[model samples]
Target: MKKTEEKIIRFIDAHKLIEKGERVLVAFSGGPDSVFALHFLKKFQKKYKIELAAVHFNHQLRGKEAETDEKFAKEFCGKLEVEFFSAKLNVKKLANSKKLSIEEAARKLRYQNLEKLCKQNSFSKIATAHNLSDNTETVLMNLLSGTSAAGLSGIPVVRGNIIRPVLCVTKQEILEYLEKNRIAFRIDSSNLSDDFKRNFLRNRILPLLRGKINPALDEAVYRTTSNLKSQLTVNERVVNHFINEFTRKKANGFEIRLNIAEVFGEIPGELLKVLIEKNFDYEFKHEDYAKINSLAKNHKGKKVNLGSGITVIREKELLCFQKEESSLTGEVEFPAGKKAKLCGVTVFIQKAEIEANPAKKKAYELISADELDEKFLLRTWKHGDIFKPLGFKGTKKVSDFLTDAKIPASEKKNRLVLLNRNKIIWVVGLRISDEVKITNKTKRVYKLWTI
Candidate 1:
């Protein structure tokens, strides 16, 4: 076995990238790197006890060259008797539609196609041809563009179902192996031109750095990134502990208690940044972290819009990181003996006799059946809405009632109210109006509850 192959096998074994009898799909672009990966996997298919297949994606950017690459990839797979799948994507159109760079759009389409193929064929692992050279380039790009430690950690060896088995080898090793084995692979013309950022780095910047500074830059980067990833794994455990302890998942987004800062006083902003990233998948800029920390110390009701539909509001002693909710409109009619779903909660009304005193019960509210019409309107509580509490004589604003109940300001909009003839009869899961309370004179009663 060659040294490159042995290294890849060792990496795969260490990472548990593939299991026995697992179906592995290789992303074959007919380029040197991907072709070598497919060849290497095929060489050890029986030894690994795995089924192998290949997929080729045509980005449609190279016109005739793209079609040729697809054809070559199909023929290569045919020659090896491996299952082949191919897809042609209008990457330019996708880039324009999504307002993303051409490279980003291509990558998005490529992964989408690969995942789709995996689901259709029940593949357990999708292997991409990301080598040590790719990782080094990524780390350098992230460093140049200003990134977090996670970005500097480079590409993950195993992300969910995707694996990079050849990550242990470098581009030089792949080229040398291909040459020694008399393998033919197609070259992407786009890669030769220095039009893309990656190509510019590969052709212009990396060579100068390697010649002038470190000749072994790739290995050095690989070692550094490996260490960073290990440290990140440990940090992730701590972040997850904090998140599970202090954060609550709501319908729209996440609610993080402000007490987390006191719990983790050592650079709590970093923890909050990671927590927000985990929930919203948005990377916060350096200034955003300061803004978040500032908001944490600011007065309640203060908020910072973090773009991308994400807003962090300070509600009393809690920090609510939530997506902007659309205007709450529309109401549903709740009929007797039937349930109505309004604003994520199911409101049900059924005719029944009051089994226990309403004051002693917390699960459901008992309302006077004679006061309600044939149906009731269930809708979100709006401003200026007033309802009389069961124990109070005068009417109170629903907003004030919710505030008195200690509900977070961010959650008040989702609170539902049941109305009879435009009069508030019950605040769902909270309290019923004094007018609807069952009394000794009431003959029939209705039970209302929410799940």
Candidate 2:
């Protein structure tokens, strides 16, 4: 066996990239790198006790060339006697529609289709031909674009079900192996042009840097990224511990206690950033971290808009991170003796006889049926909305009532109210208005409950 193949096999085994009897799907682009990967996997298929399949995605940007590549991929897979799949995507159209670069669109569509194929075929793993060269280029790109430690770690060797067995070898090694075996492979014409950033780096920048600065640049970058990834793993564990310690899950979003002296440090900002990205899949910029740390030390009631519908508000001793509420603007009419779903809560109103001891049923409340109109409007509480609680003598603002109830400010905007004739009847799941409470003179009672 060739040294390249032996190294790749070792890498795969070390990472546990494949298991016996598992089905593996290879992303075949008909390029030198992918061809080498598919060939290598086919050569070792029996040894590894794995089933092999190949998939080709034509970006449709190269017209006849793209079709030719797809044809080559299919024929190549046929020669290996492997199951083949092919897809053609309008990458340009997708790029335009999504406002993303052509490369980004192609990558997104390709991976999405690959994942779908894996599910449909019950494939346990999806393998791609991302070599050492690709990893080095990725690290350089992230460095130029100003990235965090995770970004500096470059492409992951194993992300979920996707594996890169050839990642341990460089592109030159792949080409040499293919040439030695006289293997046929299609060259992507786009890769020859220096139009894209990656193409420019691969053709121009990397070669120059490798020649002038460091001939062993790829090996150096590989080592650096490996170290960064190891450190990131440790940092991530610490960040997760802090998140669990400080974060409080609320109905609207999440809260991080800032009263702790440890939370005022730099790690807390990183903890919050990770929590936001993990929960909402929204990444914040480096400047956003500084702003969050500043907000943590600021006075209460100040807020910082972190864009993408995310807001960070400083409370007395906590920092609330939540998505801006899109309150229910249109009122929903709730007829008597009916049930309706409002704001993810199922509310039911039924005619019932007032129990002798109403306090026993905490899940529901009894109200004077005569005081309600034929129908009630169910909507989010608005500013200036006020109601007199069952025990309070004077009307209190809905906002103040929520504050007094210790409801998180993030949830106050989404609080629902049951209204009769534009007057608050019940602050759903909280207090009921005194005017609507069942009394001795009440002839009919309505039972209100939410689940």
Candidate 3:
């Protein structure tokens, strides 16, 4: 047996990535790394008593070049007598539609397709060709991007049903093995272009760093990431406890109610970032987390707008993720006596002649028409905005009012405030201002209902 083959088998055994009688699907991109991986897995198929198959995804970015790669993958698999599956996807279109980067769209689609094939074909494991250099690049990317501890761990050898047997190997080693065996592999031209972030790191930055700084950069990164991953496994247990105790499920997403007194000094920032990612799918930077941690010590009602349309708001006793309509805009305005759709709620505003007094309701709010002297502005609640509830003694800040009402901080941002002539008249869906209350002297009423 070859040294490379022995190393791969040992790595697989160490990770327990595959078992006897299991069917493995290879993500064959026709690239050098994947080609070597496919060959290595094929060599061990009989030794491990496992079934092998190959899958190719052509992200339609390079037109004819992508098709040629797909063709190469199919032909290569056919020559090896392995079952092959191929797919062509409009990755550019998917990226534009989802507002994701081309790289992110391609990766997500590729894994999604691979998972689908695994289930359809009853494959037990999906193997990818991520190598030691890829791990180093990923760690550098995470460090440069201000990611949490888990992000610095790089990619895992086994993530769910996906496995990477070549993670312990280097790209140079794979290339050498392929050359030694005289195995032909297609080269992706895009990898040489520095236009993409990963390519920039792979072809330029990483090589320069390795040559100038440390010759064994990949090995150092692999060891560091491995250590970090071990630390993360221990930290995850504590973080999972916090998540379970403090979080509650909502119709939109998860709500985390972290009590300032109990949570301020107890939780680590990295763990908090992981919790947010696990719950909200947002990759928060260190600065983003700095602002979040600051909220724990700062005065209540402080909020920060994180990227990816996620907002974190603070309250007296809780810190929660604010939920809003996915389609809601920054500044929203609604005309009087008209129906409009805003924030997934269809709100109708029409003048009505109510008999002297009407029953109090939860679904609608009826206010004196004279109160709406100016055009209605429907927008998110801003700090320092005050409203006087119909029966309350004095005006109160919207934030304070919501907190006092025991409203989850996450729902506070979704509470729209209707302002007239720059005065808050209604904390819509909650309370009508004292100035807008209906009385015996009220002649007309403006009714608001959500349908």
- Evaluated at residue 109, the lDDT of candidate 2 is 90
- The pairs that clash in candidate 2 are none
**What is the Cα-based TM-score of model 3?**
0.73
Worst 10 residues of 3 by lDDT: 322-331
Q: Write the per-residue lDDT of candidate 2 for residues 268-331, one digit (tens) a residue.
A: 5457667777766355567777788888778777889885578888887788888776655556
Candidate 2 Cα outliers beyond 4 Å, as residue runs: 60-64, 89-105, 189-195, 249-253, 260-264, 267-274, 282-291, 294-316, 321-330, 352-363, 383-397, 437-442
Which is the better candidate, 1 or 2, if ranked by lDDT? Answer: 1
Among all candidates shown, the one with the greatest TM-score? 2
Residue 241 error, candidate 3, Å: 2.9
> What are the runs in model 1 whose C-alpha is more than 4 Å off?
1-3, 6-22, 46-49, 60-65, 88-109, 176-182, 189-196, 249-253, 263-291, 303-311, 322-329, 351-361, 368-372, 388-396, 435-445
Report model 2's TM-score to 2 decimal places. 0.84
- Give the whole-model CA lDDT for all candidates, comma-separated: 0.86, 0.85, 0.81
Highest lDDT among the candidates is held by which one?
1
Candidate 1 residue lDDT tens string, 237-353: 987788788888876788878877776653265566776777774555666777778888888778898855688888987888887767766699857899999777998889888
Q: Write the per-residue lDDT of candidate 3 for residues 1-451, one digit (tens) a residue.
A: 8887888889999999989999999999999999998988887788889999999998989889999999999999998899999998789887887578888889878988998898999999999999998999999998887877888899899888899999988888888888888999999998889998888888889889989999888989999988988998898897778777776666665555666237556446765676666666455578877777777677666777775666777766666664445654454667788766656666678787875546655578888886466367777787888989879989899998987887765566567777777888877777889998888788878888766
**What's the C-alpha lDDT at position 373 in model 2?**
74
Instruction: Rank the models by lDDT, top first.
Output: 1, 2, 3
